[model samples]
Target: MHIMEGFLPSPWWQVWFLVSLPFIIIGLYQINKLVQEKREALPLLAVAGAFVFVLSSLKLPSFNGSCSHPTGTGLGAVLFGPCIAAVLGLIVLVFQAVFLAHGGITTLGANVFSMGIAGPAVAYLIYKVGTRAGANTYATVFVAAALADLATYVVTSVQLALAFPGTAGFLGAFSAFAAIFAVTQVPLAIIEGAVIMLVFKYIVQLKPEILTRLNLLSESTIKKLQEAAA
Candidate 1:
């Protein structure tokens, strides 16, 4: 859901930067705290970042000559919370913009706000609520990941709608943009969710203790999940 470089004009770009700045600041702090307090989680953090970078870089063709791809932020959001996932997403976005030219530096703020902040926030919230409600762990993860992917595009559509409402106005523009994104995004989101769920399931089976240590999943919950999976 990269908005491309120079696509957003004038005040709109600046507005997005202003909107995304606080999350960046908070994300920085969260990353620092995570590093200091949970040194052992470094490898997993790297994996999460790599997941985002690789998946988001795929760039499949979409409507209106735009492109779509999996955000891949759900795993990190689930593991470390949305703030830390934002930091990972920022890093991925920067790298893609610089090297791949996949997205633009000018639109970095908007892109981050959508894919990093908004998407991960939704995933983190869904995960928390789902787990607390005693939903199946894998199903909760799947829904979180899928919805996070969709949420990124939803925010992107909003950003686009606000920037260029044209004659149709905000609501009309929003509907148009959202429809274009949904054409490809829905199936991609489902695939992303399934992939994330499988990865998380692997982690759950291999290192349930790590999840418990992070307080993301309890020992008893893990046990129940394993039993159910079996």
Candidate 2:
């Protein structure tokens, strides 16, 4: 969910900007390193950024000053780690804020923090844990993507609740925002998860070498996925 442009009042927006700055800085560094180390990944990185832009632009009216949509950060996180994904997300958000009017420049920091930093971080962690646990590759992808979408909304809710606690206080406000987001976000998460799973499968089938270079999958697992696709 994107908290609309300028919806957040004075200090809250500034706070979020400060909080999100470090991640963005680190993400930029990571991206430069990636570009230098693996020029072959440039095209795939573009695809990931486009995926985030397109999916997140599909906004549906939700709570006041906010909207719900699929956050496509998980695929990038799974493909290139969370820091690099954050850079991709930041670029997408900037474009959305400028031309698309989906989000606002004032609240860009908050949106990036939730969708880019928090969501991708959680997704990357989940993917790592799932793979380490010997879970099915596609299944893990689904879970990571789904949970990443949900995580974005959750962080958005937190940001909203913090900005406007009202009489119900922070916890109460968070519960209210989260409840509203869950109605739309849950379904979107499931659909995004399925879509990302399919995309990952395709990548596994067609570009297993890339996965091997990235250490995303073991040779044995890539072989199995390739065979399954065949």
Candidate 3:
């Protein structure tokens, strides 16, 4: 649900833009810190960003004019952490805004804050919490991805409701969009989660070395991997 440039009233949009500027700046600073700390993952981040761009570009048929696309933030956050995912998302959204016109320039700040920042952040939190609770990797990935996708829609709905208060109150708008979007998003989330889990499983099998370098697959998991490989 990308908000067009002039969707909101001029005065309100201007105020929202001004309020969102600090978040953009903070996001950029966090991105810079991530780059400095995780230089090795830069190439991976680029690759992941490219993947997200391509994946999001492919629109699946959905309700009315609204279409759904895969949000690759969950996989990225799980693998590289949310800081990098947030930066990757920002880059992807910016490119899409300029080239594809999927989202708008004036609404870029709100878009980035909602889809890029909130999605990955919530996904990472869910994944972490699930893992801590002794959930299986696949389950954690699935739940986190689903929640992340839902969270983005919720955030987008809120933005839209704020922009067009005549439609409904914030909660009402949020619930309406969530219900509409969930039809497409829920299935997509399941598909994405399965794909991510399978891909992770294969990568661990083919190049366990990469997992070790990333400090992802634990020693116990490595043992299980070797057993499975055998």
Give the candidate number with the greatest lDDT: 1
Position 29, candidate 3: lDDT: 77
Which residue runs of candidate 1 sit more than 4 Å off their true CA positions?
A: 40-44, 58-68
Q: Which candidate has the top score in TM-score? A: 1
Tens-place lDDT digits, model 1, residues 1-230: 78899999998999998998998899888777877987866777888798778877776445445456677887788888888888888889999899888779889999999988999999999999998998888899999999999999999999999999999999999999999888868987887888789988988888898898888887888898788788
Relative to the unseen true structure, what is the C-alpha lDDT of residue 91 in candidate 1, on a scale of 0 to 100? 89
* Candidate 2 C-alpha lDDT tens digits along 43-127: 8789879977887777634444345567888878888888888889889999888878878999999998998899999999999
CA lDDT of every candidate: 0.87, 0.86, 0.72
Residue 170 of model 1 has an lDDT of 100
Candidate closer to the true structure by TM-score (higher is better), 1 or 3: 1
RMSDs, each prediction?
2.7, 3.3, 3.3
In order of appearance, the predictions have TM-scores of: 0.91, 0.90, 0.81
Candidate 2: residue 39 Cα off by (Å)? 4.1
lDDT of 2: 0.86
Please give the RMSD of candidate 2 to the true structure: 3.3
